[model samples]
Target chain A: MSNEQRPVWHKRVTEAISADELAEREALWVPLTEEVRELVSTAILSEVDEHAVALARQHIRAAQEILGTKVDTGSFGMHVNDEGLAWNWGNAATGQKNAVAPPLCQVPIADGVRYEADFGAGYEGPPGCLHGGWIALILDHASGRAAHLEGNGPTFTGTLTIRYLQPTRLGPAVAHAWVETRTANKFVVRCTLSTEDGVTAESEGVFVLARWARKPQED
Target chain B: MSNEQRPVWHKRVTEAISADELAEREALWVPLTEEVRELVSTAILSEVDEHAVALARQHIRAAQEILGTKVDTGSFGMHVNDEGLAWNWGNAATGQKNAVAPPLCQVPIADGVRYEADFGAGYEGPPGCLHGGWIALILDHASGRAAHLEGNGPTFTGTLTIRYLQPTRLGPAVAHAWVETRTANKFVVRCTLSTEDGVTAESEGVFVLARWARKPQED
Candidate 1:
């Protein structure tokens, strides 16, 4: 597995933008992403009539046309700069440009990566609980992030095992992940998801650094 | 274990809407949800100028306002009827009204549950691959759906173990799940996610029938 020759299928665009330009672009898009997420939550809870739904559709269509006027083909692969700055805004877990992503805010934790998100109507599962699949997503993302920080390269999920101890309620929830063990190129990470009801889900995962992304100066 | 008294936390609402009304509602909301998903993908790959971006925001805001004028209080829990019709269009895995859900289309199969989805920019993780978390989601959902049909109750995922054999490329992916073993109230399900590249990920899961959802006539 250490020398697994997986093809590099990811998009890595080399951009000439400066740090300031990247920040400016993020500023421009973050609000739009947030608003669209809000729109999703609202749409889920909305009990509007036919007329209102029609009007909403009209406005949404207009927005689509405007945005679609000039678009890039395929997915939003990672955009990296020569100065070593990299951003993948379309990431499914924590992408700033992904409205479907969970509204997770990463906290500066002393031990591992801590993420806090209010599981709303949009994240419902059994009744008033966060979907079990989202639990897996959060753990995978947090664990990969933790591994990425330590590995200093892209870490892909190799295997994941999760236990749903309790139904994660739809409200403020927290996730904490840290690398439990690691070799030269692989990491074992553990994570937990908790709400006011305490730890609802936990996971253990294997992550490995992509062979192509490895640097010659090994640890 | 069969008599495990886990708290019934799932929302089971009895609505008075007719079957015809339910179909009508789905027709109305499914389009809105679909368009929003398209918007999300568009926003991720859009490289539009400042003016178009600004204009898109305004239209999106207007849609939000119109939808927000009348809203419900909380999550769209399962809406059931006296005639045994149930609809949870806000479900995370395949809710018709949920724009955040992967665009999965369930196909009728003789043995188990089957689902197909075209993973786009909105579901990217590694470069051009589907996020690992979403793979877990699809497997969990398809397996639970399979168990639900045979068990005749809402089945919750108790434990899940997934082995990602290869990178699941973003595009047409198929999932097939079936109950491999079963007890009085618990089902051991197996599922696999496949793309044109072959089976990329597979899973084994424990699904338990919700005690509250069990009918008096047991198998």
Candidate 2:
């Protein structure tokens, strides 16, 4: 559907979900998820409109070429509309091609968002420490969700600061994210990750200039 | 053996070994890989003193705690030292307790260090991108090796900064590390990670306050 012709559920879904809840909803929103997957796949196949798929493919190929190998264990999926188009490419914790990630998929909800996943070995950093970068990934996703919730089109990680309070052990961990403030296209997002007992990590970030790269494709 | 009574080789091994081939008389001067492992393990276990057996038991318990649980999978085997002390708590990429980690093991080279390992599907981020955290873990290990080489005693990562110049893919990758500078108890280390052809990641960091933490016994 065209941007103006898109359904309201897209907006509702984007606004009503938490990062954790959205992750849980990945299976439930299979139709929407599949729709995005198909659209992006088709766009890439046709080489027609300049879309997120084109941009992602370009980047992915650049990375692969530089690294000198084709990575088959991962993929990028996307969906589009006037409210915004979202693309999650080769997400490590949840990509089909990723052998070292936790299983993760996210959707939209309310003014904030939530995400949850179970991680196992293949991400070790310390003797028993979870590689710190995985922690940053979760934070970045949460920050991105916070931006998405505030309608900040799309943005890149301008700066990210993470504190390793304790060695994050790999296991089932849950994360929650949401917008704390917004100004023009700039947004402040607050997030937290926890397991069954207490919090494992906390994060907050500022996302700016939604659609900074290209005006949220006029659809 | 107590610190004062330990074999002279124990103290000599930590020093830099010459790269040139050793004659039979210089054999003791050459650092053997197995010997180095034993020495470090011995030094690490030295702190346990009378608690060596208890420490081994803890290692077993910690390993058992994660095994067959939802988290134990592609991790490395952690064993105690000849001093009969063990530390299987966990590691970022490949500790026995870190379920989300990969298999990482250190090998002592002529005068520095090298690491070997394989990664799989679960650690993806971005599309086909290795989760940023996985990169950090590899970098951390590389940096840590640099610290170990400078003979700066075991050090904690005071701070680590990583720039994701490009997304990393899964599969076989190699990392090499060495010391850049040393100041008293502080040592500066730098390292890099590469695929088959060229460098993919580079890291630099400071390792300081040698042996700040007393052995478990002293604590």
Runs of candidate 2 with Cα error greater than 4 angstroms are: A1-90, A95-99, A104-113, A117-133, A144-159, A167-213, A216-219, B1-78, B81-92, B95-121, B148-154, B169-172, B176-219
Model 1 C-alpha lDDT per residue in residues A1-219, reported as the tens digit of each score: 011222236778899999999999999999999888888888887889888999999999998999998887677878899999988888888889988787577999889899988767777777767888888888888888889888887888889999999888777789999999988899999999997789999999999997877777753
| Per-residue accuracy of model 1 over B39-76 as CA lDDT, tens digit each | 98889888888788899999999999999998765678
Q: Sort candidate 1 into its docking category.
A: medium
Query: What DockQ number belongs to candidate 2?
Result: 0.08
lDDT of 2 by residue, B78-165 (tens): 4344443334323444443232345466777865568866543334343334455566567766677667556635555554544444
Interface RMSD of 2: 21.8
Go through the candidates in order and give each one's DockQ: 0.50, 0.08
Per-model RMSD to reference: 5.3, 18.7
Q: CA shift at A138, candidate 1, in angstroms?
A: 0.6
Candidate 2 lDDT over residue span A1-219, tens digit each: 132321111121124445565444343333222222222212211212223323433432332232222222112323233444343423444443222335455545554777776543333444333455567667777777567656735544433444444445555567778878766666677777775446766765665643544354532
The parts of candidate 1 lying over 4 Å away from their true place are: A1-8, A215-219, B1-9, B215-219
The residue-level lDDT of candidate 2 at A88 comes to 40
